[model samples]
Target: MSQHTPPSPVKKGKELILDITTAAFEGKGLGKVGEYAVFVKNTAPGDRVRVRINRKRKNYAEGVLLELLEPSPIRISPKCRHAGTCGGCTWQHIPYEKELVYKSGHVKDHFQRIGGFRDISTEPVIGAPEPFYYRNKMEYTFGDRRWLTDEEVQSGRDIADRDFALGLHVPGRYDRILNLEECHLQDPVSFRILDAVREYALANNIPPYNTHRHEGFLRNLIIRNAEHTGDLMVNLVTSGENDEIMQPFSSWLLERFPEITTVIHTINDTRSPSSEGRYQKVLYGPGYIREYLGPYHFRIDPNTFFQTNTHQARALYDVVLGALDKVPVLYDLYCGVGTLSVYLSGMATRVVGVEVHAGAVEKARENAAENGVSHAVFEQGDMKDIFNDDMIRRHGSPDIIVTDPPRAGMHESVIRQIISILPKKIIYVSCNSSTQARDVALLSEYYRLERIQPVDMFPRTYHIESVAVLSRNDT
Candidate 1:
């Protein structure tokens, strides 16, 4: 809890030594300089290392690992070749089991420190069945140049400067690609799809997109393969319609691979380009892919937001269902595509799902009807505004409320609205534990935290998806 101090006068390029002391903000792993906490990367709570000051600030300092004179006991060698470069798995150096412990502790610590909550339990984190190659989706970029390590540059060979693809993207660099042979974070199917795409693009003389120049045939290659069901969706983001090129590629793909049910191409012809919300074109086969979860089948498009780990998603959803405890009337807020409601439609007497996206609401209705579910009703509107007295009177006040909010968690106004309704049982699923903890603290005035389960939805990463059930307490 120490504040950052001004850095001493040192050469800009000179390496300064510091002993790793404690954990800092965002679990960057902290080191100290004369009682001041210096946020350093790749070093844990207790470790000694020589870090070269990269950027000095009055508040904090950024440094690179010049030499690890002594490594921490918690540090483990990363398995992936592109671990540090890909910017995907930041905490891979930490041991697998230890990573869960640290992540869970990190969530609890943030809640206790920031959310003003004292009753939060630091329970054993629920880990994934398969730690490695568990991710069902991976988005690999197509870049012009590759980034090289110091060792490659010191070898007197232009290894990175050569014309090649740098597998995944670097942390901050938009155009620079980090060449990777294999990323263990994804399943073998992901690697296969990536390799095939890279080979096909290279052989066809297609150029990777240069974000700076805004030119090239290829932009992004996103692969999604479900674990429960072997459904594959490949989204190829390009500049514009290239049917002449995509026609043959599509044929070649479907001829050889039947797993790729959906092959899509999206066009982004704008000065300020983005991957989100752009209208995608269906090149071949179906426009969407289907993912089976227990009794429900989820149809996913390119832009749909589904959990990365399909295996653990079942566990997360099960926790939500368990919180309902067979309530007759249930309300699901922020129910994207009505996944939860669709999954629990059989158990509940009637389920009401509220969402913002009109298209998603339509899809949710279609999905529910497809599954022959007659007890579910969906409406497209703002959750806070739609939960009025009229709507409540029609749908009936929910005995159980299940909310899966975004990373920012529920807005203060929405929390107040929920408090006004005051359901018998509340199940909250959150991607950001800090925000969830804050909401829980606010709701603690009316409800008590019953059982909190931390599900490792994204393995090999520091993110945790937690489900907290709160029951109304008699004061």
Candidate 2:
């Protein structure tokens, strides 16, 4: 007898009521329609929501939430008014404890699915002490096109100056900016500074850079605050240098906010939309601020790459340090500003940090010198190009290797080099778990995954930082 296959329960462009049963990776909510999985965004598990199937596939479907028929029991009111709309925080509505569970589960699931590991040891995700007001840096854009919310459009209020917006870009809409009145990611003082700058720009008729025409003055405003030290920096990126505008503006800003320790003016005359400048000039006080992590102090310039969340960075480092023993030599890959090298220098006989950016390598050396550590050295070269046998010989063979690559994760060539070197222990720190799992799978031939520790460096968001410790099989 032949059996007939049933059709899909949901159809493209069709609306249906779905009960979210679980959470999926990347802040998606998972629901099933007749055993067929449906993924919806901006929803929580145990939520009864009305969803419209936007994209249909043979196995699963993607949906957009239309209405929340019933809120989940684990859901809570978001602290920020822009929680659902802003691209900054995704799991704001979910309870923080539940969020940590989801994040930890995500790490385990990645290792199982991507790395093909079944019985790897996984630790509970370490939660942040404070969720809101944790970010040390905030970068805002100046846009001419403001995105209006549904509430604003429904109220029928006459909005003024729709061409001016001084906040973050709308999610999935790079050209449209949402005029944020408040943001919880950074401290309260950041919002105050944001408002002050917006008011000043509107009052003085300073034009925001237009991406389409590539003609305007103001581009981006970046704020950096020291978590341990009470220092603050404000970096203003503009299309051109105009002393007539900046001289008075800096004076007024400093006068208004005396807590602001430094103000920098960066110029980008070209059409590129990058916040980075061609050259920068100090408008007030010093051009850089000092930040402290553990016993070491780091000089943070406008372009310097430092950990965004300061409080949890210490905890994350503690995890790395806990897994280390007194070693003859340690190699830090993609080491920006030598934070890890300096932090772990106390236990290692010598530390070598390699980075691609010349500026970051210079800052790393300066930090090492400032910390009075002569045992650590910073080198400048692309990891794939310089991490070879010659480089390994120049710097003694490392007993242990610690790598903290970017979100894109480490390059395959660099991973191959590490495998060839066969260090006794490799500590992998990554902000993205999927790529980390893939890299670990690639190294599974010679190394055994010892432990995976997930740290919630960023709360109220789906982003997670994980530290994977592995040891050589023979050792």
Candidate 3:
């Protein structure tokens, strides 16, 4: 959008070798070619690489890494061979220390540029204790067409032999999956489970679902593990009913991996797993597992939203809870499972959690009663609808409010509603800082940015989770 900048250096499909000066937003490498900015994927701050111009825009260009001529001083050899191909762990090559630096930069840039705020303090990113194997849940896709390496293509290997793959989706290619030899993000037992499932599906001739044709037996394989309890839940998502095929396989998994405490068969009749995946039968053990956040225990259903990394999540919650000073009445917007409100119920006279999902509200009530939290209340309704002035006057004003919205951030109407019923403090937790910054900008009219703590929930990746405390400007 800057008029003084020069045109892009290369046209679409052109190739160039450039020196990457810094990391950009979205985990890409930033470089300039004669005042023309270029963003190349799979690169580091000091990397010098050859790139192919994948897309040409008016102000900037997008590129794909073709060759790495020189590695960054901070770059380390990626532990996993499928680092770039798997589309997970985009920052695995960068040193963990440098990764923290870049993550801090991301928060600062988003606030300064997007929110137009210059004085917010962005503390150093809170690093994960164990960077690798930190993720508690991983979903492996089942594709009939497995992605082949360049060497395999060149070697004239039989295409039929490479037909089936139960691994990660190829970046931007949904029809193919890169069969994982090993993955570092989850427990190695997860990789063992992947191998076992793949082997069983192949031996039984259970066809992998084709996203294009929308016909197959196996669609997706989701695995979740309780980090502290070492309890595992394996959910085999299928397109149609094949109890005979899945029943035996689920039993085999429970027998083979004693660590696997639960196995659920999710019969998904719909095309996409996200739209229709539900727990049809608990083949082994309980259908859900309990994850502990401090003394509070949460019954985590396989399909529900729980923090993927529990260790860093605790740190984030502690930061938010520590910021709240006065709470006679508290309102938690976008309160999934009412975890935050439940965690702070004892401190407040009454804690009201507002969520749109009815099932989640039901579960939150169950969780609250299970934890002996009598002061917390959950209301299932749209935030915009429930956060009105009449409702505020009836329920009484809240001393403090906390919201952790989706990546889209709080809607403008919801933000305005919050401004109307201004609380003493607003604790905003978000995964997408870009949208968070925009929303914070709107609230800046009545609230002052007090503190920002960036927590790395997902390590070895570009994603960041931030908890921001905004004080009432009047207060």
What are the lDDT scores of the predictions, listed in order? 0.78, 0.92, 0.87
The C-alpha local distance difference test score for the whole of candidate 2 amounts to 0.92
State candidate 2's TM-score.
Answer: 0.96
Candidate 3 structure quality by residue, lDDT tens digits, 1-475: 6678544468999999989998887789999888889999889988999999999988889998989998888888899998878898888888888888899999988999999998777988889989999888999988888999766689886766477888898888878899888999988899999999998888889888888888887888888998878789898888877778977898788788888889888888776657237447788888888888898988888777888889988898888888887568988889988777788777788888889999989988988998999988888888878778876776778889889999999989999888877888999999999999999999999999988889999888889999888999889
lDDT of 2 by residue, 1-475 (tens): 9998888898999999999998898899999998999999889999999999999999999999999999999889988888888688999899899999999999999999989998875899999989899999999999999999888999999999899998999988988999998999887888899999999999999999998988889999999999889899999999999999998989999999999999999999888878888999999988999999988899999998889999999999999999998988999999988888899999798899999999889988998999998999888999999999998899998999999998888899999999988999999999999999999999999999999999999898889999999999999
Candidate 1 lDDT over residue span 1-475, tens digit each: 8997555654346577877866553546677665555677767766788888777766567778778888888778888766655778767777778778777887788678766776677667889878888877787777778777566778987563355573776777867877667888777777777777777877888887787887876777888877766778888877777889887877777776777878888776664546542578887767877888788887787877777888888888887776667778888899988888898776679999999899889888888887888899998888778867778889998888888888888988788878888989889889898889889889989998877788888777668888888999962
**Model 1: how far residue 331 lies from native, Å:** 1.2
User: What lDDT score goes with residue 227 in model 3?
Assistant: 80
Segments in model 3 whose C-alpha atoms lie over 4 Å from true places: 1-8, 155-160, 275-279
Clashing pairs in 2: none
In angstroms, how far off is 24's CA in candidate 3?
Answer: 0.9
Evaluation by lDDT, superior candidate among 1 and 2:
2
RMSD of every candidate to native, in Å, equals: 3.3, 1.7, 2.3
The CA lDDT at 123 in model 1 is 62
Ranking by lDDT: 2, 3, 1
Error (Å) of candidate 2 at residue 337 is 2.0
TM-scores for every candidate against the unseen true structure? 0.91, 0.96, 0.96
